[model samples]
Target chain A: MSDQNKSLDPRIARLELPQGESIVKPDEYWGTFEVFLQEKRGKFHQHVGSVHAPEQEMALVFAKEQYARRGKCVNMWVVKTTDIFAFQLADEDMFATTPDKQHREAGMYKVRDRIQEYQNRQK
Target chain B: MYGGGFLPEENPKKQTETVAEDPALLADFQARIDRGEKIEPHDWMPAMYRKQLIRMIEQHAHSEIIGALPEGTWITRAPGFRRKMALIAKVQDEIGHGHLLYTAAETLGKPREQMINDLLSGKSKYSNVFNYPAITWADVTVIGFLIDAAAIVNQLANSKGSYGPYCRALERICAEEAFHLKQGHDAFVYLATGTPQQHEMLQAAVNRWYKPIIHFFGPSDKESVHSEQLMRWKVKMASNDDMRNQFLDMYVPKVREVGIDFPDPNLKKDPETGKWNFSDPDWDEFYEVINGNGPCNAERLAVRKWAEQKGRWVRQALATPYTKSTVPLA
Candidate 1:
């Protein structure tokens, strides 16, 4: 489990209500679904927005209306908000790194200058 | 899609208050605009630019939310499951657009809550077209198709504006609106070509909405104020009359093709100049409606107030301090 999930309140982390439980509203329990859309065949699905739906079919239908109504998408995927794990804001520093990675950039190589020098010599 | 015609400020003095910037800085700013560089959120802007952008974008955000109410009423009453789902989603998209626009406007220094409060108190004005009511199901189609089409004309132009965030927001909104236009046109066609009763309903709706549609673009350029500087700043992308004429050129033929007659006897295009000439929709009534005396003005505000009140608990609940027991993701 992720560190963020590990730190979640035990009451919520351990809580799993039965299907159709009325204590907490379905919207609150069934929760949101994150939508991803692929604009056309073979394209990567892009994260769009979330929708509230109790089931997958309903979620897809809602996704179609919310994300694909303009024919901007040919395919979509909806995952339960709970099923998706994300790094916590507290863990954002994990992405921080030294800015000295010039070796990975094209500007660091000077390939164009070297090629021009070679072409001048060949001429 | 709905923002057209700048609303006059309630206090002219507040609008004219110019904070003195260094002449060089002002010239540099204007020079950057002349060079076609977008002014980012953190960029230095003249006080007037900030105020006018806030006013224009906040009014647009307000228009989105208020505009939702008229067609939102028809969600449950839509003819079928297909129409019901589409209406609900369309209205939801409108509310989402409002959220996006409010965020864009917030970048100009006004809080969304303050902007909405201004809307509720009538300190801020939405599009005047929404001030009129959507009286029938046919009205919904007319609004969705023609009104949205008009808004597209305006929005497409605004998308080319110099404000970075508002332009970006309009780009996405215009894309979504393309589908709304299609659905609207489909529904309108179904009713227009259906039974004679359906056709009559649609014709009446077209007649009822034609004046408001004309009014949607606001007053002519000849009567408008303060547009010259706005155009130079790229804040007002197109003149109201120009957008109205463009809308007519694109949609009037399609509307006529569907067999619905516009109420205006003089709504004909001048082939010589490619301008639309029509009897002026009653400007007096337009002024009165914009000043808060339209048929559905009070009703629209009341409904918005009710939604605000009813949604307060949910907002409050969401605002509650996160507890150790709370699962942030869920």
Candidate 2:
């Protein structure tokens, strides 16, 4: 009912501050875009954070300010988070490969040992 | 300082006591935490774990948003051009930090709009310190220097915490806070070492803020109804008492070195135990302020409500019909 609550901050005190008027529906927000930042020219643009925006261009604008304000950013990319087809974190086990794939490993076939054996066989 | 995540202990049963999750999944999750791995958004976390993290992160996000206002009020009134520019940057950084924390919280299933609604309707709590008014430039210096220093202590500890997104957000926030602390400390030192009038104003501001500073780290461990599972999960990196002691040990000397004395006569550390002792900062006042009866609580929420209400049209206009907003996968 009051124009403004009595505030020590003069600006607030002078304004007609509104109260109890927020009615944002659950889906009434701009979509979230995941922001990736490249620290330098040669670096990969790693996902730093996300920003909510109306479109791709605005997302990049917001992403630059929010994620790259402090860092030495050469470039940035913004992709809608909904666009990302990510594997669930619980499926981390799926990415695990058997360590016993020794045949596939470079260090498995030891050239040093083979050379030593060949010289000994010659002797 | 932004105090750690807090929920009132009224519902102790639902809050921390019972484990209602599947034992096998819970054990697997606990094992992952024990191995020093972060809990990502889609991980099979215990219900209690998800609930508590959401509450804590949401509280932290709200604190960052509301925390900007007290110092922000001083931007136009800042004494010099340089101070004004620094204050402006610091305020923007605080708002940006709030957005980062909100995104982090969203990964845990709560929507950002809902969080804002809860904050506006007073269903959630933020750091209690922000409810106090910054009446003078000296108050701004105290907040910028000391309060931010305290936040860094809490936030650094939280950055080592188990939650992935929250830790990442805190890392960025803590980095930016360095500039805020330095600028604040410079101004506080100027006031402390300046003329008698400046010194008097600084002292008065310190006296007003001393109790809130003590209340910054939440209740001491003895009084707090915290769960041990939170500690085991790395959700809580340190106890409230340990953090308070650390803050005092690091900062008491800094304040004393500049000839600005804390209002308490009994503030001192015991050489034997390395613990500082001081007069009781009224826990009653702490509780009352948190319950929305503080000097600036009404004003703070009122202003926040205004922002949400005023900004609604732009957000609504920007909403696209085909866009589907989902939880961020990080």
Candidate 3:
């Protein structure tokens, strides 16, 4: 924990920084915040937000302030960017097999309607 | 008087004090923001406006985190498997809300760690209502139903706020809160209509939570200073009193319909004014709670501090030596 304040270790810093062309990106320091958004409490987490923070401590703070400012957030997860494995947007089509399916959904409203229809038929 | 659109009336108090900003500059800023311009981190804003937004947003973030504790207490001891799962999901949502709010604050160029450190150091504020203890399981339902429902009203108003990110965040939050309100209302309905003992428990919970709900909106407009600047900046879309009245107008009848009595004897609706009148919350108590003197303040802070301390290793691990190569953030 004491090491949380220390600058990047010399060996790790050398390994992390890209050489030459990749270094063309001007913003050398990039941080990742893992975001969990709640529509409200008692619901599954929706990935509605993320932010960049240099450290885990900062990320936690950033996550709460950035993601949970409104009264609706019930929880948040802020993790360093390196930990999350996500597919690139350039490969978006590779993950889009059944991207738009609206017909077969059955939850909350659907269940309510189905139950009401069944009760009406019985009546 | 009813569902007032955008900004309402000019402040009469401005006659006594010089308006803080050059009217033209403020108007220009307001017009740009009204046109759906995104106010970036380094954008020019009035000092008072920035300070007020920070206070409001940070307190809101703190409220989301602390609001979880009361309901979180009931998770393990919930009456049944379904209730337990519901409580767990609710608490998780509270954590998620905290994340959304923190990000909102970060856009203001304030360091997130500084805010958390301030909260832990007793230098920041959260909602005053959270300072009250939740001593009964029925209190959990009251929190979900009445408290969350009231919050939804305020968030709905904020969805139209002038600040771009805050407005967007409020839109998402208000959408989620619709579910939360229903879940809480369902829980309250089950308890309120169940066994006699359950009914009594819910009645007691309502009695305890009612005053806190009134206090939830902070204070009347006269007592608020930053409110005008906040309104001008589109930071706060509704006055504290206006939001409180909306809560009472919506929830009071709902509570009565459920066969429970709210504790306030003074609660009555003025038909002509279209407002519900109720006894004011103790401003002293509200200030005390915001200043970290309320009943649950110590416990709430202790829990957060413990989590931070206990999780120190986890945070350190993420910053460790070997994994740095594979995990280049950029």
| Highest DockQ against the true fold, candidate | 2
Go through the candidates in order and give the C-alpha RMSD of each one to the true structure: 12.2, 2.2, 15.3
**Ten residues in sequence with the least summed lDDT for candidate 2 chain B:** B4-13
What DockQ score does model 2 reach against the true complex?
0.61
Give per-candidate clash totals.
0, 0, 35
Off by over 4 Å in 2: A1-5, A98-123, B16-19, B223-225
- Angstrom error at residue B121, model 3: 1.1
Compared with the true structure, what per-residue lDDT tens digits does model 3 show for residues B1-330? 011111122344642353477778778678877786656444567666666566667777778887887677677778899888877767776776675676677667565566677777776677767777777778888888888888888778777776655666667666667777888899999999999999999999888877777777766764455466567667777887788888888888898997998887889998999888887667677666666667677666666766566555555555533322122111
lDDT of 3 at B189: 95
Residue runs of model 1 more than 4 Å from their true location after superposition: A1-123, B10-17, B222-225, B322-330
**Per-residue lDDT for A50-123 in model 1, tens only?**
55455667669867875675665788999876678776644545767645678877778767888999999999
* DockQ per candidate: 0.04, 0.61, 0.04
* Best TM-score among the predictions, by candidate number: 2
lDDT of 2 at A11: 87
Model 2 agreement with the true structure over A1-123: per-residue lDDT tens digits: 243448988888876777565656776666689998899988898988899887898899899889877758889999988888877776777768767678988888789988999999999
In terms of docking quality, model 3 is incorrect
Ranking by DockQ: 2, 3, 1
Clashing pairs in 1: none
lDDT of 2 by residue, B32-116 (tens): 8999999998878887778888998899999999999998889999999999999999999999999899899999999988998
